[model samples]
Target: MKRLSLAILGAAALSAGSAIAVQATAIEVTVVNDTAVLETRMPRALSDYGFFTDAAGQIPSANVTPYRLNTPLYTDSASKLRFAYVPKGKQAVADGEGLLKFPVGSALIKTFAYGEGEDRRLIETRVLLHRADGWLALPYKWNDEQTEAKLALVGARLDVDTPEHGTISYRVPNKNQCKQCHSIDDTVVPIGPKARNLSSDWMAAMVKAGHVDAMPQGTGALPVWEHRQEADLNDTARAYLDVNCAHCHQPQGKASNSGLDLRWEQDDPTSVGIRKRPVAAGRGSGGLNFSIVPGDSSRSIMVHRMGSDNPGVAMPELGKTTVDKDGVDVITRWIDAMPEKTF
Candidate 1:
């Protein structure tokens, strides 16, 4: 198997007017040729280089900051922690509608793990690097000992047992699969870190610290997905679906041919999948008549896809190998509570 070690230069290479350098030493990264090599236990793994800090240790890294999204994708029952960092001389520019145009060489790291304390098992670490050539997605599978992670280019599947949910099959997506959801206009982009997702205090601090250029005036904040207990069921369910499905279901996305728009910003109810018929779902529709039925989830093709893990029938063609029971239940409840409407 081929191996590569990159001495990632620090932000000092950029213009001098930029912010303070985030790091002094070159960040070393190990690249493997194939998944089979990573399957074998290898010494001096990716984690040994210290590009990412252990959240459990609570040690502060110069450039890393915990980031939150208004709504996030559901990956079975695993918990996720996300952080992002930019090069020394670069600051992310705030674009319209909460999107931030990150400078080249920025990186976003997300870790997936199950349980807490001694029982905690690190599953994987996904890194999105904004290289000069464009964004690259790398998936690293954590060792059973939690000491390190190895690059898995072809991806891997593992059966894990959870406390709340029994045995579940988890899938780690490959580099190409990452592009399935991250690609927009044929270019890979960051899904999270939108200005609307950041807390008011956090956004203000980011602007004050010069980490970001500035927030658009009169921008409204979006509620965290897990903290929407007080929101109405419809709003909560819409938010969940928007994050999980809108990435591809929107008009500008890969699934635009489906004619369904799941974005939270979409105000038209019919466009939001309410009584909207499928355009090209084919066998995936399960012979259902409408995308959503006001008071009947069993008749809703959207819910059916969410409940299925079959490749031919699933709404999302990649990333997940198992159904999100909690997410399905939420959608089911939301549908059941909807008032019956007449055409």
Candidate 2:
């Protein structure tokens, strides 16, 4: 068995502007498998915090301040093997055997599958390393169970390292930075093709680390606050949608053509336009009315879109790869719970 380390390398680019020097860093990552435990260090830097909306559009800085990074990288028996969910504090680990990593964010990442074993493997994911603290794992799925054939991330830690600048820092990706890509909402609501596998062990460990609240009880839609409304969705729901939907449904987002802006604070059933009758045969099929056909949940186009996997339809348009039964249920309840429509 070969041991490997997964490192997210950040490249610092400097440019001289007039008399001042400007510096920018590009994220680079790599995953290797050899055998034996491996230790890898990623240079780190302290940066003033900035708000970045995730694919879902939620902001994470409010929850975890001071963006940080995890430096050392490696895999373990507990790491993600195939398409598994990424628990809060867990990351994927791998040995050189059947796993392969590619250079994407300037670093080599475990993206696709390889070798005959890969075809038989059920889960796939990229390993994320935290310097000493630990690591986590993530994966993608497209069914409704949200549990079967699913994967999970385990063992993430942050390590200390010295950069070329001689500054000591942890090369860990902060909760917010991780949210930037993995999360659908800024950092509040997590949505995407990838998900956090809510394994009992992983959840318990994260709670012990003080990184999360008690392990989530309900294994459905992202966490939502009590008393949230669509027009007045509570912070949690709004945040989740912002991350999950706004990425494509926003004004300039890819799915903007549908004209439904799912931003938490501004989700308007009216703006979604009269739900277009599902004429074309696709994922959003089987609907009698448009997205929310005034009081008719069964006929609503939005319901159909949320319940599909036909590729050509489905709400997020991409990434989901899995149908969130909990998410669907929440939406169904929300739609059904809406007061009898006047229209």
Compute each candidate's TM-score over C-alphas. 0.80, 0.37
**Model 1 over residues 1-343: C-alpha lDDT tens digits?**
2122222232342333332332223222222122322222322354532445333332224465667666678777677778776555579898766567778757777888889867888788887777666777778888776767888777798888776667878889987788778877667777777666566677677777777788754343555666666667777788787778887888877787888988878878789888998888888889899999989999999999999989889867777767887788889999988889742
| Model 1 poorest 10 in a row by lDDT | 1-10
Query: C-alpha displacement of 325 in model 1, angstroms?
Result: 3.2
Best by TM-score: 1
State, as a TM-score between 0 and 1, how close model 2 is to the true structure.
0.37
> Candidate 2's error at 122, in angstroms?
10
CA-only RMSD, every prediction: 8.3, 19.4
Q: What stretches of model 2 exceed 4 Å from their correct place? A: 1-240, 272-287
Q: Superposing every Cα of model 2 onto the true structure, what RMSD results?
A: 19.4
lDDT of 2 by residue, 85-139 (tens): 2222433332121111111111112322212332222123233332233332233
* Overall lDDT per candidate, in order of appearance: 0.70, 0.34
